[model samples]
Target: MNKKQWQGWGPDEQAEQHYLVQPRALAGGGDVRHVSAFLRASGWRDKSKKDGPLLMESPDRTVRVAYDPCILPGGWTIHGRAGDATVEWSAHLGRQTPVEIVAGLTDALTRPRSAHAPNVWAPLQEQNWHTRFADQNYTATSPDGAAWMQYRQDADGAAMWWTGAKDEQGNGWTAHFTPNTPMHLVQAFSTELAGPDPVMRPRGRVPHSAQIRTWSVSVKPSQLSAWQQARITAARAATWARTSARSTRPRTTARPYNPAGGARTRH
Candidate 1:
């Protein structure tokens, strides 16, 4: 479809678009942890015509992962299909899955011809994605080599909210860490086609990743620090400006009832 046509399409139309992103790390097996993945998928399907991308990244966006060179998340357990599969996933947020599941999934997936990696992690969007029992802090690294987002839900089915291309600052945002980019998380995203859901769940002691991807890199250290500072300043300013704006804004009051004269009067 043309750019205009793509932009004008509705949610259902967009949903019909199937995007498959099989971004996997081709690391030789031997207990390797650190990994990265860039998932890009997009497609369109007719209503009720079960058409989905082979590698689905939440709805219509991509994500990244950074690992801490530890357990390669050798576990994966998928319950339901994408968008509703969260029974055991929510419970396992931020924590390593049991050793048994991990070993099983990895073995099955890594077999030649059956080589698969359990990337089925919870909502990486964090903001838009919904789930049951939301947690304020949860992060996971997928076997796909990307880390998950810090969502606000936990064990129960939550909600998904998708904010379009515009940022709250009214500035156009093309990447994460933009300060106002809405988190486009999937309540129960698609399943991990490979096998076990090798994701660490919430309450995990391991350090969580800053779910943001680096779109641009600076060769000079000075430039990098400046970039970081700009973002930090923007974030802080956004917070304070929002708070101050709210504090100064006048709230609308309900019109007073006039029972005696039956005439509405403004107080």
Candidate 2:
């Protein structure tokens, strides 16, 4: 970083004051690569302030802005750092692609039964790969349960990948992730949709959940003691269930059939 001196309210100010400007010429020419510039504001207000801009100079030598938004609540925002003190921050807003279904689950609607009104939705099934909206978790579903959506990956698959799991009844669940760009469009109410595909959830965020059978515990016993214990427990439960079932039946006698002495009918 280089520094210079300027006078007055700004560089244009008639008053004489010292100001600083660090400028660079675009390297590799237009055919090769574009150029960039960094500026530090000084003297006009306080002694030390810094600003940066990534620029693509005009072929005709005019100023053109590609994409730049400051630390505010608008598009492409960067926020949450006063001066870097090990603080955590996030950059996301509420934008979604709305879907209404009686039973289907997606990245959007996975929460309490009371969350979705029965008029439009059935209860969330565990088989779906979705979980409820957490406070720190930025996800959404409308009041009537008609509209629902999630802030999916804004970047291409080349940069990042989203992994997820489904509940027993197929409710979808996504682990929390950070935004690539400082702030991204949350895809609220409106969805940028593609053509048809069948697994029922959005093609972009859908993850295939392996069919996990609980009986694996019995199949892959970790220890000799565990296998023996499972067998004993299962045997006891089966015997108890059988006894309980038999006690509920009416008392009856078995007819003697082909006994050593003779075949005898019940009295």
Candidate 3:
């Protein structure tokens, strides 16, 4: 009987890795070859055969990205690290082309850095606040459920006012602070809803809207078992080295050679 093949990274190598990006498909329909090509073009190295996951990494060995070609259309995942911080985010491939999906994910991960406060909320806060918003339209709460922030949109304009306090049972108060609310208050409201350094949430585009869309912010835990983190780090470094070697090598362009050694004069 044939043996079942191992589908994941080696047991000894899984520790050092932290996923930077994880792309998923709604029902599993994406071409892995395209994913590989995209990574190579973007300066990542391909370390495995064409049939395996298109694993690659940055030239500096700080970031790694990959997707399993044999996993059907389930999705793709990219892992990256900077300093002591590690980040992972994923999205469903949906109906978009693989190039588009990968580009979007790459752009989100590689874009310029901005100065922002670190997220103080825990993962539970990040998940619970959004869930609550779906049920209650004008209510916001901290991760611990100890504080509440509420807002209401104006009936005539794109204006909102928010109040933060102990709970929802306080005396009702309203204010018209449109167009210029305090930054600290805004940050407080944002921190309560989305974690620190929030990326824009992914919502399908609005019809006929020309506004520039924002990248969704989905952060993952940085803490990992030592062995698991090491495995990922090693994989990324190895993949990067392989691709860098190929990219830096000189290419010889093939020219049609004449059978005769002598050059023929144009007739």
**What overall lDDT goes with each candidate model?**
0.27, 0.25, 0.39
RMSD of each: 22.7, 31.1, 20.2
Q: For residues 25-114, write the lDDT of model 2, one tens digit per residue.
A: 000011100011110010011111245433232222221222233433212111232124344333332111112111122111111133
Q: Write the per-residue lDDT of candidate 3 for residues 151-198, one digit (tens) a residue.
A: 555556464444322222331112122324333323432342333322
Judge candidate 1 against the unseen true structure and give its global Cα lDDT, from 0 to 1.
Answer: 0.27
Give the residue spans of candidate 3 off by over 4 A: 1-34, 86-98, 114-132, 135-267
Cα RMSD of predicted structure 1:
22.7
Q: TM per model?
A: 0.23, 0.15, 0.29
| Model 3 local distance difference test score | 0.39
Better of 2 and 3 by TM-score: 3
Q: Per-residue alpha-carbon lDDT of model 1 for 13-106, expressed as tens digits?
A: 3222211111211111222111101111112111221442122222222221221223343222211122334211111111132222223322
Query: Residue 4 lDDT in model 1?
Result: 56
lDDT, candidate 2, equals 0.25
Worst 10 residues of 2 by lDDT: 20-29
Q: Model 2 reaches what TM-score against the true structure? A: 0.15
Q: What ranking of all candidate models by TM-score puts the best one first?
A: 3, 1, 2
Sort the predicted structures by lDDT, highest score first.
3, 1, 2
Best by TM-score, which number?
3
